[model samples]
Target chain A: MTTAKSQRTVFFVSDRTGITAELLGKTLLTQFPGIEFLKRTFPFVDSVDKAKSVLAKIHDTAQKEDRPPIVFSTLINEEVRAALASDRALIIDLFADFIRRLETELGQESTHALGLSHGIGDELVYQKRMDALNYTLSHDDGMHTANYDRADVILVGVSRTGKTPTCLYLAMQYGICAANYPLTPDDFNELALPKPLQPQRAKLHGLTIQPERLAKIRHERKPESRYASLENCQGEIRAAEALLRQAHIPILDTSSMSIEEIAISILYGTGLIKRVKT
Target chain B: MTTAKSQRTVFFVSDRTGITAELLGKTLLTQFPGIEFLKRTFPFVDSVDKAKSVLAKIHDTAQKEDRPPIVFSTLINEEVRAALASDRALIIDLFADFIRRLETELGQESTHALGLSHGIGDELVYQKRMDALNYTLSHDDGMHTANYDRADVILVGVSRTGKTPTCLYLAMQYGICAANYPLTPDDFNELALPKPLQPQRAKLHGLTIQPERLAKIRHERKPESRYASLENCQGEIRAAEALLRQAHIPILDTSSMSIEEIAISILYGTGLIKRVKT
Candidate 1:
């Protein structure tokens, strides 16, 4: 072990996009905050030569640092995974272990496909998600208010409360037709449901943030303006909260939450079923 | 097992957002295409009461159905995770086994804290990602072409070729300042980079899709129109590919690829370092 160093080389290896491996590795690494990770992702490692090169790199790092580097891999191919399996370092095969357990439980052997998780495994679902993404983009900030009827969820929030990114994530990741309406100063004055959202109150999901945070976000976008002033932010948040409370709308505070957290919370709070598995 | 049906109830339980459990579970389930899973996510299960309810549900499902249900979990807290650990159903505790292995290798004990993965673990990185997302959104589809100087990567592709979503994903997920430009007939006719992009040629990454797939995608948006015609799609794709090749810009085929694949490919191909971890 390299007791003198606090940093370790970490590899997120995959046969396709290494996003899943990266996410899982990051989640695990977060538990050890005292250790620093110099991370790299090697995606599309679908060949024997590629796996050999990655193994060589791992061995080199281990020899140089006198510590084994961590490898978080999602390589699905048996041949490639077997080639990469070595005793030089800690190799975490995320897919192989789980797939074996699942295969046993279900009494069926898995396909062991290389890229099914993020590939076009189902064309219909992929098409639906793309369509939903387009719809969400077009309907952002109530651009097309008439399309509210087609939306599965309509997020209402003060400007910069993360309405747009949350809507995009829901649509792109979950295939949910999410439309976000920014609560403007005019809408906050009435403290009632906006005219466009009146009939579609069932789909309304309110997003809120701390006043100071909102002001700081706005200040970055527009410095020294009325819109970026703390007083304006406080008033808008107060009015928005009052409207949400009065209308019996569900609200989520996004000041310290990540997009994943916010999206999952909305799905649970609204009882919105996943249109696609991932 | 019920031979008459292919359905199974699945639970994603976690101490925090449950995103990791859901993602890992979904990836594993995709290998078994024959099974139809009705999935549910229970987030913020930090309390013993919450764990008891989840256990009760799992037990109830196992009794109701001839086969046991599947529960995928990433609960970090030992007490809460232990409460739900049972033999009534298949429990895939993602954190427990991996954390034990990681701890042994590092010669250290994990903090075992709850919700560190998606929480505000680093405020600076979170703010930087938010700022980058705003930048990408504002510069979407060649909006504010003058802002190209600030972009870490600018994606160029024909319309409806998965440019916008890829840009957004790169920015939101990795905190890379990504902007996209849609190539029109005018740019193709000129056979040159767009004037605004000429100065930033090093930052350009081109996206190309199969003509047939592009046609089908366009047809969905605008049916039977000239814009969606096969001939037009073919011509534009040919010209786009030629322009990218002649300009020495790397091109990615988005025909059967996913956004995650495209974004990671761009990052690797362009050598753009991620501004933040996912």
Candidate 2:
């Protein structure tokens, strides 16, 4: 590929939120590390007119960039998908490609529905997700210790070790009721599980971070505080790891992991993936 | 398909979290409403041995169910993918199909690396997502109104209208700093935008829910309270709608929309999609 062609515009178009298209498209793009993708998302393009307008935009981008754009689409409507057919852009329709093979395999025609993926498909499942979110919120950072019995998994970690966001992500994405407790200096002094978490030991998963990263995160939150000092971070991490090891709790290093990676690791380690509804 | 063949086991297999495979797989499955899919996810199957184990599990499930299973995979390693090939199950390798096409179009060879999709690819972008999550948490439910200047979008609605989760989802998924404020009975009295939100009028988006649904959600949280009464919910909805209309803020009815739907609606309506990093 020429140097100019290495920079291309990529569009993720979908009849719904376009999250699936964007995720799959971006994942594919990551394989080619040499290219720089200028990304855009056209969501809720459920009609022929909308598809036409998006195609026009893609055409404009191709003309402006002197290179054809790459389009990843999940448009379910046949007419809308047909309207988006452009020779100038390399359009990869995710659903159209897979649905044909699936139909041949299943011996059934697809519904071609617009928004079933992200739609509220099952009422009870949707309610359960919302319930999990509410439960996670009320129990964040050890706020409601009495509710530990209802939690699918309880995360034990130091502050800013990514406890809150992981709990919230588990609830939002997988409908898992994840509660987190931030281990403090007092708890580490004893090198034991907190009293309230003893009965829930089987559900406990620990997160530890490198002292340098922990200090950096803390310093961003509380500049110039002792809590953000490298020495204090090192002491807390050492004590926390010792306590987790003593209790036989599975531990994950969150130093370079993203929130999604951390959540998935905890779920797999604790056998909580079985509890995920969707 | 025969009635006995309506039920089939589906497996989402991946080298990393299996999130992309599951999401895309489930979305495709939604097209066939008549078939009942029993789904399982096998994440972090990065090696040949792990792939063999998962295939063994899949074979066992197929035999137990008296039918072949459907497997959707995003395994990037060629040897690992080859190991998972089985006649007992219909394996759909998502990356294998697309990467070939992408390679042909881009004239580049894919890295075929594992875990790049959910991994921390760019440090600055990953940190920004965490920053967005922290910002959303601190500004949740009208807290830290002083920091409204830093928000990408401000969601205004009554309690239990799906504001908090939507805000968190926007932050977590898109790295958009979203803040939410709950309109109380006091604000309904004047039918005015809250005083703190006056200067940030352009950043405002409103969420409204059906009275019946609102009452049901509230009753689940606070049963037998006057706050959960349908009549009270009706009055609040009417007043909040009037206030939002008077303020000219865009309104989204959350009666049937999922959190993803609501967040996308708000982002598109407020033109905040441009600010989304990923």
Candidate 3:
């Protein structure tokens, strides 16, 4: 080896939107090996000061090292771009570099082409899927549960019980159309499926959380609300469980499991669908 | 090997609150092999009907294939649990499955301890990153050239030139605060960096999109606007490139690239950062 692994350094920079960039960029980096990369996250794309500091560092490294340094920057502004353009090292501008090329090849005449999206499919499929989602989100009833009539499954739970995020995830990440609902204390006592739910009970599934877990989740938003109180939380949980048990409904306690686990379990138990990759 | 090469199946399910269930579920799935696992997603958990269908299917499958299924259900509802309690299969409930264990391990009363978050990291760091981005967007003062400060890099280009999207992508995806500004008609007419941007000329990088491509992009957004007309787009692109060339600014033509490719290129070129494993 030329030197100790620790001696080699690397950096990462981005504009105002830094979180998603890191998530995707970092995920993609796993393919490389051997060299040690030092990570520095840069947020904000509007400062000459930051660019100057980066430039000075680049110059310093150029004189001291035999091996060239690598810098990855996602420059979004021309001034910002001017602030860091240099010959000292390799620079990557995630947005500018790619967009220019994309414009040339795809924007030549506006074929009305839709770009690929992460609704997780290739461009065409992704567009179609997202279009479907937009329709569902906009046209679905106030419950946000229309065309859910076509759903292989539907989910219902209580407030802050992890419904919306899961539904969108299933639809986007795996292309599942999931609908959700919150159970009120009144529903627990009366016990036929809630009003709108009775008609769809055939596909209905419920997610219940521990009173403590529910309280913990609610506390983050409003610690003092009755919704987050231990006593109130416990009462609702117990009553709900009793009603569900008497009715013999299938349930999953979601206080601990992540979203993927829940979806997998349903697929296994219901035999609704499967991802083709695996 | 039972029927060699059978894919393992994973599902996500939730009733009441599929949000937490889905959020956690998708994150967990990222850990598995896509090629080896078949993932299915379901949302909205009402246990009664969904479970009955599941039971019937499992019964049919067992009677025919003589094998019970391996299912990872989130079963958040007590009713769902009670109903499926008799199933002869491997079953799991995410909530019931992990709560008590965590309580014992944490040595805290589950009821009072409620501040756990799903995402891992520091909130302050995230906030700082966001603050930088907001600052970059609000002010486009061109002081980056001379005593340029606080910018990793700047991007320059004409209006409708993919600056905003590119900048946002970089900031959100990479935590790289990228600032972008349009090369207004005035900049083209004057053919010089704005006063504020003049000092940081060395660090500035230019984005050049082909005229035809620019026209196409503008057309899609505003088919009838004068700016979207190909003739105008062509005129602006040619003039912008000339000005950039005169200033000796390094330029990237983003005409045909995916966001991933663009980001990777910037990271590679800038010598600012390196890749990381997910």
Candidate 4:
């Protein structure tokens, strides 16, 4: 059995994808550590009936738990937002709280539009993002080096040190074309920059992880293999770091960072954020 | 020269990745269609010195433009936030506005942690997301049908109907293991579910696009080829729609939708969001 004070139901409601509401709500919720928040998201809730149903669900959960729920909403439609009003829950309407101030500051009436954030705002921008995704995919893992000139940033790292996901994240989130090259055991033996990366020195950034963590990650894919040995992991990382440092390339230790953090760090370290429109 | 009222500079400042601030700020700015916002983001502004530099940059831009810049910040540190304060711009501090209300409601003090939102929260959750990304990558474009049983959702669509990016987005954002199969001419002739997909009927979702849009997209990849012809696009889309209808698979038309929108709609259509923890 759970106590009412320790357990809470939270809802993220929005007219569109509810991504902003979820992101902000989750960030705020992370502040309180002990409470367990069971989250539910209601996306595309653009109608009064949908909002009313969400309100009913909130009330039902409150009744069952003997405590009120918390609702983080980005509902732009007035009637639909009104339908979700309830005294039983802590309703934080994000847009309603900020839009009025923005209107007053900007000295204009807001369009009161729905789902503009996730919509295809500019056709050229959307196309560029799609193109960037394709570029990153085709250039993944040193698959195509002919297009290295087009890459915004090229990541050099040992396998399982977080390269592919970070590249994909850069392309997906910022529409930046990123390519990655995996440093192999053979390259470690030579302790020199890979031939293909030599010409793209200015775009190169290195990622290295702790040897224990690298071994664990590699062991997940290939258990008990020589490649997953801690000694091998340590040797490879040492060689890779030496080569990257010799070349004067910036390196990021990704042992404790998320993909978002790694991507953002690369963007800032390489000064590529200046070129990224998003 | 652009009028001062018609153009304004916008800045997204944060102690971490600045993604949440940019997302929420952009959503708010979209309401004012006539104004053009030149945007910049300053991530990792955790120190007072860094925040002061950003403030100076904002003031410089304001002076050059003869209009105050709009600053959207998610800085959690009080000293850093205070250093960023200035009368030259409209600074909308997201954390400052809502954290107080949340603290009052929860009856608890916030950890006031820097970069918690984008940080690697739980090791298991982070591992799941990385595993999901690896799964989606390996299953891309029907590469590994042997793992269809493990997929959360299998997307079937003709080439260039926005399958690959949508799959990547679902995996990266929601940690959903999405697999996509590109429907070819042979599949259209059979008008039956692919052999590998027959057992995974419950996980199947279909994507369609307007013939003109499909033609344009194909043309971008392989210009002047028969694959980019309008006749071929129309034939493929019609056959794909008919086949999906026969299978009773839910379909989404991706003519004007963004990748985020397409991904969210698919999650809702397939009820996969229930399985996704994040």
DockQ of 3: 0.03
Q: Chain B, model 1, TM-score against the native?
A: 0.95
What lDDT does candidate 1 reach at residue A88? 85
Docking class of 2: medium
**Which digits, one per residue and each the tens of the lDDT, describe model 2 over residues A1-278?**
54454687899999999889989999999999888888888889999999999999999998998877999999999999999999998888898878998887787989887788788878888888989999999999989899899999999988889999899989988888989999999997686799999999989999999999999999988998999999999999999999999999999998988888898887776678766555
CA lDDT, candidate 4, residue B150: 86
- What ranges in model 2 sit over 4 Å off? A275-278, B64-66, B275-277
Tell me how far candidate 1 lies from the true structure as C-alpha RMSD in angstroms. Answer: 2.0
Residue B158 CA displacement from its true place in model 3, Å: 20
Q: What's the residue-level lDDT of A14 in candidate 2?
A: 92
Top DockQ prediction, candidate number:
2
lDDT of 3 at A197: 67
Per residue, candidate 2 scores C-alpha lDDT tens digits across B204-239 of 899999999999999999999999999999999999
Q: Which stretches of candidate 4 lie over 4 Å from their true place?
A: A1-5, A189-191, B1-5, B63-66
- The TM-scores of all predictions, comma-separated, are 0.96, 0.96, 0.40, 0.95
Flag clash pairs in model 1: none
TM-score of chain A of each: 0.94, 0.95, 0.55, 0.95
**Model 3 regions lying over 4 Å from their true place:** A1-124, A135-146, A243-249, A260-270, A275-278, B1-278
lDDT by residue (tens digit), candidate 3, B159-258: 7555544554454334565666567777776877766667667556677777887787677668888988888888888888888898898777766643
- Report how far residue A143 has shifted in candidate 2, in Å: 0.8
